[model samples]
Target chain A: MKIRALALALGVAASGAVSAAGEVEVLHWWTSGGEAAALNVLKDDLSSKGVSWADMPVAGGGGESAMTVLRARVTSNNAPTAAQMLGYDILDWGKQGAAADLNAVAAKEGWDAVVPAALQNFAKHDGKWISAPVNVHSTNWVWANKAIFDELGLSAPINFDELVATLEAIKKAGYTPLAHGGQAWQEATIFDSVVLATGGVGFYRKALVDLDADALGSDTMKTVFDRMAILRSYVDDNFSGRDWNLASAMVIEKKAGMQIMGDWAKGEFLNAGQKPGDDFMCFRFPGTSGAVTFNSDQFMMFKVGSDRRDAQNQLASSIMAPSFQSAFNVVKGSVPARTDVSDADFDACGKKGMRDLASANANNTLLGSLAHGHAAPASVKNAMYDVITAHFNGEYSSADAVSELVAAVDAAK
Target chain B: MSQKWWQQQLPKLVLSPSFALVLFFVYGFILYTGYLSFTDSRMFPSNELVGFANYEKLFALRHWKIAITNLGIFGGLYIGICLVLGLMLAIFLDQKIRGEGVLRPIYLYPMALSFIVTGTAWKWFLDPGIGVEQIVQSWGYTDFEFRWIKDRTMAIYCIVIAGVWQTSGFVMAMFLAGLRGIDGEIMKAARVDGASSVQLYRRIIIPMLRPIFLSAFVVLAHMAIKSYDLVIALTNGGPGRATELPATFMYSYTFTRNQMGVGATSAMVMLMTIAAIIVPYLYSELKGSKKS
Candidate 1:
């Protein structure tokens, strides 16, 4: 019934043009406040090119449910034109040869020169472009309330020691030093960044990304767990089941000093009409500023009939275009996927993200985020999440947690 | 003879489609799920058989243990509370009370709402920052606190509370029906014997409602095992897997985490758990009927 209603509405909106040209039916889970606005950029871009978009917006936060729907649709041989996928999920679909060959669009757009290699790796399957890169979201970011920071005469922490000191001072000032949500994914988000901060980018990759037993069970990993415990201690009793945005709201209201979250939390600040660098300060999670943990949101085009292939091409071109990339990522609270896109209108935090991303890219320090499905497969990442969150919740000691991580990753592998 | 045969065949013909649907979709799928439990499936189903490897892994995970522990806590509390409440309400309404017709519907109304709705409403009502805690604090009781939904140790109780709220009324209706079916002559005789109202219930009425209790237990036990949406909306097995149940674990593993084998194993375990409760009850029911 909902599908019929949507089709009827699309038919009315299209009138004669849909049959004249082709329609792009994009399946995604970008229905939140800021996410919706950002998605309109891609929609309007396609519309400007005489292509119609049949919006199939599934409104799950993490797109996990959307992937289930997509899998069923594909198995039924009625795949959508495109779907919003992350990291190896795109590759997973590509391995099935379910995604389209977008080399036609890629060659025309000079994507090889423009799109980042890291994003391109997942977008390509067997050396063929199957998806279009949209934006880069670095997960290891700390959003601090500038008001609280200034009142306390503190700067953003430069290391784990400094971060602890800053948090202690924030606690002394009688504030939630670290605003946190108690969900598994939220806990893993903090752990992902903490992995980078505790060890350098190399250690983060070896342990989290590669599931290395030596790195996972080492004393360094134990200290990472210790730091995680310290971070957990800073949260209040009311923190469980709290939405990530609400945690961001704590920083927005100056009730909390800092939030360890992805760049997407900027949307909450933006929604609250708070400007970055003025109302808040954005930095890489302490000791990890030099590196970036990235997860790119890519739209994988599916194999549609010849009739709608033109619309798919139009979508690919529009999405890959520098102007739309800038416009979309600006609203999407992510940096542009294109390295060459100008950061002129980007906010202070956005500029920092762009600069850090470029430097990380140059220095080979850009690692994919585990919580957001960039570093490992879903099974391995979820295993790590179980261990990480269980440890974070005090189900295991730091050493036990480290050993459990090794066992979990090994079992999943 | 032809006319009689045609009339008899018509009912079977009318029911065949639904019966076939139930057989193939329900029972057939169960067998298929059983098969998948033994295979090495992930992200998508596969043909590779791994014997009981998935089940072994599923049992070893700490999260799975936590999920089972939560189920025990939730299921026990949910069933115990609902049964007691339902019995009490049935007794209250059975006393030739005023506006019984009006009151019965009020009691059963919560059963009409989906657990999702019940959960979301209760989530708001129980969450510390925005629910009762915040409301009470705002009312000048600044030290007042209610954070059970957020507390790892107590989060499962919040689910139990919501589950009972949605289901106790249904249990009440079942008991009420059971009460109405009781012979009025027995109650009159008990009254003549100088039995108190409480004694009448304790000695005769309650014991007579055994079948109703059994039926309610089976229903509630199945619901407790399959408690997914309520948990999802209430805590989503969160505050670090504190409220995780087998159903939610099965879903997250199969769909979200792409560990379909472990998920199927969990599903099989849940099916066995539910079957263990229901099969014997069904056998006794059928055997008793046959004996009669």
Candidate 2:
């Protein structure tokens, strides 16, 4: 009798497990404090819909490690239900036919109409919705300590010359002019803004995104390198191997005047309990106000079992919801990916980011950031990183840098 | 079956599963990587072989050239310094000093820490702002500067320093054991013959530790070739690829840069380099044991 009872109980447990709400395994690199908090909002949203979340978090700043993990997972046919991917990596994965077709949920939720064309370019692969973009992070922003600017009597610089003058003034006053990390990505991030500022949107598109030989090796490219060299002089000697957040902390503590970083740097400032307009100021990198170099974080759905399709769709739809978009990006320090989302909940910097993104989009200046893996494929981007970083470190002259850039891009291609 | 046959067969049976696993996982993956090096695999492995195209590209890359050069400097300095320092420490410890037991563990403690931990701790210690330079400056020598970790030319040496610090202790243990195993009668006879300690070590004791030296070289050479975590935790092959080694280049190319073919090529090169060192050593060791 006891044996029969035990077997009956085991049978009941098995059926209960099978009939429970399906699971959505999400792989992401958003493991930082603010990022984790933002991710929790989505996790809770999914949980409310009777789907359990299997978190596969890989903690690397650039999502490089996460991409490696995702590749291994997909190659082994154990792909996560959803993965937080960025830029060309999404399209690359989609091209492999590993990404699920999310046209059903996307069309239902009208993702085509809401997501920006720039984002949609990556979100859709071969006319099928493959990823749901979460937020748009623009790289051409300068975060400044407002107190230093106020005390130094320096207004926001309007152009490259004025920006250089401001950095000189700040240096003359004995503060490190630029709070910058010496890492390759950080240097490349600065390069993104410098290129946009030096040659405007068209040249940036030609030189970085299109990888045009003439434009890359042109005298204008040499001028960009010269400006980069000038900017390099303003950085502190101890900047080598420093993390990006530590650079942000320099600005927060008034040790440096400004930092050229993505919108994510604002998270560090905000996390330090500083208000946007009062304590710190966010402005477009000089001369890049009308243009934005952007990379988006998107949750890409992977092809999975038929029984879990409903949960996958639910996760996709939830990610694209305007409510989640606004709430998540508010904490994530990036503007919402959706075009129609209101900026009422955003802080001063968030408001500025939304305004700049919209204007850049409307003006056809919404270029993808090469530094953040939006403009080029990983091979080309990394090749570019090598030259840009080398140039920043004074390893090459301006003319040599331009030629090297051309050569590197051609070789990588 | 005979009792002897059962004993031998049982041992083989007990080891076969692990041996098979090692063969399939290690050698099999190595062969697969060698095959992948010939293909145009990017992001994912593609079966389409490109016939030495990846090798040509790998050779053409300035980054790979820099990585190879850095490896030479790091490997040479790391091995040379570690062997010297380790021998000196072992010789000192072998003098029957007070608290030898306590001192021995202290010397070997760094080996117990992972390369990652050693790299990170040394990275902080070598940084200009918060480490040796700052401490020196605070001591009224305001002009003191130790920013090699930031200097591209000097950054590779910083890696060598960290590598040496981590492995020299283990190397010391090897040398100390070798020193201890040297028959005391030989040392006494040398002392009675009016030979100084330096002469005794140079002419006799050092020559007797040839196998230990070879073993140490083999160990350090392989460690230097496979040094990824330490470099990653330290300079991250940065200040503009100055500290890049083949291992880091292999990883960034394969995983980050989407140049899996080039990464595989680099990996195969590393494998060949390690084999060049290990194979002959293994052969001689086995041959020597057989003769004995």
Q: Whose DockQ is greatest here?
A: 2
The local distance difference test score of each candidate is: 0.90, 0.92
Q: Best by lDDT, which number? A: 2
Candidate 2 chain A worst ten-residue window by lDDT: A13-22
lDDT of 1 at B68: 94
Task: Give candidate 1's whole-model lDDT.
Answer: 0.90
Candidate 1's DockQ: 0.74
Determine which window of 10 residues in candidate 1 chain A has minimal summed lDDT. A13-22
Report the lDDT tens digits of candidate 2 across residue range A203-293. 9989898999999999889999999999999999888778999999999999999999999999999889999989999899999888889
| Separate DockQ for every predicted complex | 0.74, 0.83
Model 2, B64-143: lDDT tens digits are 99999998999999999999999999999999999999999998999999989998999999988889999999999998
Model 1 stretches astray by more than 4 angstroms? A1-15, A18-21, B135-144, B194-198
Candidate 2 regions off by >4 Å? A1-21, B1-8
Scored against the true structure, residue B208 in model 1 reaches a CA lDDT of 99
Listed per model in order, the count of residue pairs whose N, CA or C atoms clash below 3 Å is: 0, 0
How well does candidate 1 score on lDDT at residue A33? 71
